[model samples]
Target: MGPTVTLLISIGLCLDWAVRAQQDPLPRPTLWAIPSPVVSKGADVILRCQGHLGSHRFQLWKDGELRDERNTSWQQAEFMLRNVDDWRYAVNYSCRSGQGPLWSELSEPLALVVTGAFPKPHISSSHYYSAITPGTTVTIWCYISPQGPSHHYSFALLEAKSLEPLQRQSPTGTPAAFSFPSVRAEDTGSYSCVYYRKTAPHMASWPSQTLELTVSGFLPRPTLWAQPGLVMTPGANITFWCSRPKMSSLGEVIFTLWKAGTQEPLQQQISAHLWTSFLLPPVRPENTGSYSCTYMVQTASARGSEHSEALELVVPGSLPKPSLSALPGLVVEPGMHVILQCRQPPKTFLNSLTFTLLKVGTPQPLQSQSPAGTSADFPLLSMRAQDAGNYSCVYHERMAPHQVSDASEVLEIWVTDALPKPSLIAWPGPDVASGANMTLLCQGPSWSTRFILHKEGSMDTPQDVSQFSLTHVTPKDSGNYSCRYQPGTNGSLWTQPSDPLKITVRASVPSNTLLITLSCVSFLLVCLLLLAIFCHRSICIAGALHRDNLKRFFCCPCLPQGVCLPHHAEAPRDEALYTEVAKERPSEPSVSNSKDPEGVTYAHLNLRTLNKRQADPKETPIEPTVYATVSLD
Candidate 1:
């Protein structure tokens, strides 16, 4: 055969072998020590390897080199390691199974430890304190005094709970120190150390005494607050602030927001500052409940602070708003009982409803009530100034799926002493004549927007205004009047009563008769005075003139030249004088001598002396004159 054919034959055989190996794959075995892995000096131990039932041969390898081989028809094989007196007997040993030319995978390695060759070492932590805070650096040392002179030594740190070594190191001298940069709560446990020689007789010493470690208590509690307040509408977002006092350590802290009755947190955050914030999703009606927060130092430990004070969140549900009203009036004096009635709208179908009263700044409900009717009455007995505030109410079903209604319009309660006193006064005067118009002007504080005027004893309705006008006032209208005022139109408290003012109405008199009497008296006095003056003057003139000359002087020019004063002539002894003047015209015939004439004039004068004698020359004489007319035509 040529070389090409030989090579072809070899490739075919390899392919056949590969297919057979895949069809009959070997199983890996488990290895274990019959006695404990740690044996004292001069003790014997049996290392056992377990594999498939059909194993033909078992090979034991120590430290990656073949040590012994045994042919076995059973599923397991055991090898005896006798008199383990030196550290060289302590090494990694493994086994593999083989049938004919094929061998199985190697079993897991088993460690054989030799002890009691020397005294136990000493293990201790670097910290002098019993408990250590998380994130603090820690160190554990394993010390073994050397006998005679120092030799090459290696050490292993082991936890009491686990069989395997946690860490291994070669030390240049005694007392191997293992440094942990940062320790946590999970690092708290019992630990020990072992030392072994690094040369051919790698003998391990006995384990040192177990050292116990502990992590300290949790950090200080944090404070929590909400932004935009605790009460809010649905679909609004809110943020919670979790803060701690400025820490001396510059370590990261975790903030967690938690809801009540739940174990898991709603949100969590990590920040380096003294405070952190948590923004929540848009709220709904179901989100209205209590919440809290806590913080933990960001480390591998589970320790954290106590929860902060709980905060309540409110999200009012969708329902028709109720109406709120105060009985008697919105403005009332202190100590007066006021009823705030919250009423549902007409045709409300809900039954068994609960009504809650809420204030502006307070987070929780001030009071709650359940009523059978459509309205709930909250009676404020003995109201005080502290009870005054903006208030609202809401209603909800008492049963499952508790449906809540929207908040009612805010109603403010004013509790104070009645307003200030308002002054009341009559415009013209307190007294008025019958049938006279009178006005009562009422004045109050400058801030007062309303005033009320009332009568002392009358059934009339009180007037609500700044003033009252009363026309044609009668006795009935005359009464004591007072006034009160309110600060503003926003249902402010009413003021105390002002000082009362009395109104008087008097009867009037008739004026016509008095006017007539006065006129008559004045006319008579003027006539008497004029008569005395004329008579005195006439008498003075007569004393100086003759009787004939007096008649001529007094006669009318229209009379005849031969006419004489025969009708009235001389003066009487009592100093009374009379004179007559005829009325005749030149164009008419004379009728002076007739018994009845058309017209005649008469003059009478009377003069009186002071002592019935001649008057003094030094004083002027009084004139006495009187005139009268007589006519027959």
Candidate 2:
């Protein structure tokens, strides 16, 4: 073989290998729609084919047949389908990219759906009302006419205004249902449905009629209140007002009144205003019950608001009025306990009585009590100024066919220390002579209706006056005194007490002089008793007469007027004898044998002495017999 022949054979092989490399296939391209795969009738669409950077040609295929081919310098080619309509439904599209003789594999297929190929279908919701309540299950049904062919059909639920399909369903039957387990506020809008054949040429029916769905229970609750008060006497008319919020949307509404224990509405009213009133007939005993109200938006799909707070209507006065009283009086001090008692009338035949205590200005009962007896007591513990008010009570049967009694008479309760202290002054001085008249003046605020003079250690009583007089002041009247003022005639409240003033009563006689006079008289009587004992002893020493005859005697003592002394005489033997000797002084000098010339009464005694024989004669010349008399002048 020659060198030239071998070189030509190598060149021919190299050239053949290069030509084969240029014929090999490239990587697959990507195919997608510009807006979406689904389009309404007569809409334009763009099918884009994207491939490798150096690719020069792109071919679009519909149902495996070449529909269009494009020569482009860019990496992606867009095929614009102008006036795309319903006949183009169920179209499967793909694309491939080419570089000279080399070509890329086909892309994934896309199903393009066109709607409105046949007559419109009928669309409906499970809810019949114009408005739907939230949290409820809702189902929308799309179906062809009954006469239409029942075959494999698909449905699409679309938002009419947005032109967006929310869901799709393919069912074997003629009618298809789309379900929402729990509908919400955002689900409220216009909705429509359409059906298709679900086959190669997916011919679709026109959209159904637009159905409006609204949600309820989003408005605030209305306010219900009664006119002429919650509690009323028999035969009184009441008007209940049901009012919606001012900012709520304006619409026709139906207001319904409902009794607590009954399911049926008591009344219903329709109005366009925010508020409306329901006037009830004259009330009776059987009319006492709790009430509430609600309003509904008056539309094809009516929506209702929450019920208002309960309003209780009380019709009392069917029975005779009861008596009400305050125990331990109406006036009480703060922190003290008080009982407001309601009692049934005598000879009343009602049973199972329940009592309600009502304050004058309070809309509701202050308290309730059901006693075993006919009376009920409402105790106010730790009473304060806030507890003071005019109160009354009414009684009713505990069980149904509730019969009520008229309110008892109003009772007023007062709490002391609501006012300032008053000033108490004594006229003609706090200290006055006994039997003199004195007055205690109470000065307080000009608004005070009455004054109360309080004496220490005595029960205080309210008085209407500026001065309290003491007719005959005595030691018994002496005490600490104070005063307080009451602002109302019937009120129990009082002002704080004034500073206490002490009263002292002086007697007629000087105490010191009386004491001295009593002491002198006592001493004189004591001395007379001693003198009588001496006189009796002196007579016993004589021993001349018989014991019975030898008696000692003395005169009674001279005493001042209103004074008297006791005198008695008795004989004593060999002992100190006491006698009371009193000298009676004559008014003028007199000479009498029985009395001394000095006008002083004297006691005279004569003694007989016995001498002893010779032995003692020389010792003391036998002292002459001596006699002595004792006297107290």
Give the candidate number with the greatest TM-score: 2
TM-score of each: 0.33, 0.35
Q: What tens-digit string does per-residue lDDT give for candidate 2 at 349-370?
A: 7777778888898776667777
lDDT of each: 0.72, 0.74
**Candidate 1 regions off by >4 Å?**
1-221, 233-237, 246-250, 261-264, 280-286, 322-356, 360-386, 395-403, 418-482, 485-633
Candidate 1 global CA lDDT score = 0.72
Write down the TM-score for model 1: 0.33
C-alpha RMSD of each candidate structure in angstroms: 39.1, 37.8
Clashes (N, CA, C under 3 Å) per candidate: 15, 15
